[model samples]
Target: MPLIDKIAWLHLHDGRILSTRSRGKDAYYLPGGKREPGETDADTLLREIREELTVTLDPASLQLRGVFTAPAHGHAPDVLVQMTLYAATYTGQLQPAAEIEEIVWLSYRHRPQVSAVDQLIFDWLRELGELAE
Candidate 1:
């Protein structure tokens, strides 16, 4: 199976994580996307978040949380996504832009509303007791 390499920002606030739903999309995803050629995870995350959420991430605060792999949502059955997750501090107000349709704060209870890979993230957060509703 082919793997879609991606990076994601894990912004947690008051036990909830930030999520984004793009225009016409049914599932929410962590606020980040595919890495451009030769881009580092931090590079991809900073760029994607700026494009989708109109915020600039603080590079000094970037931390590696985890890397996860799961079947890619909305793709062929065997296609996979490998996501490098980061916890980072960002500057500027978060406003939906580019392809984002909505910005939502999600808890473990909101798992069903997210993609397969994101569901895994919710599970991880719940295991750490950081996703209480």
Candidate 2:
């Protein structure tokens, strides 16, 4: 199977999680992207977040939450995506930037709107009572 390694930012609010969709995408994804060479997950994530969401994540407040993998959305059947997820506090407002076209707070009820891996994350969060909405 082909593998795509990426990082994700998990920002929660009132039992919901923040999700974003790019200009031409159909499914919302956790706000983050793949790591560039010579960059750590923190480095890649911070830059991606700022570029996509216009927010600066607090390095001191960043914490690894979990890693998840599933069939890569919008890719071939044998392709998979492995996501390293981090929870962090940020400065500045969350707004669409770059290719981002929409930002929404997602609950378990909205699981179908996200990608396969994101649905798994929602399931895990719901079990922990963090995404009960």
Write the residue-wise lDDT of candidate 1 on 15-89 in tens digits.
999999999889999989999999988889999999999999999999999999999999999999998999999
Badly placed stretches (over 4 Å) of model 2 are none
- Tens-digit lDDT string for candidate 2 (59-113): 9998999999999999999999999999999999889999999999989999999
Error of 1 at 16 (Å): 0.7
Report lDDT per candidate: 0.93, 0.95
For each candidate in turn, the TM-score is: 0.98, 0.98
After superposing candidate 1 on the true structure, give the runs of residues whose Cα lies further than 4 Å from its correct spot: none
Window of ten residues with lowest summed lDDT in model 1: 124-133
Tell me, what's the RMSD of every candidate? 0.7, 0.7
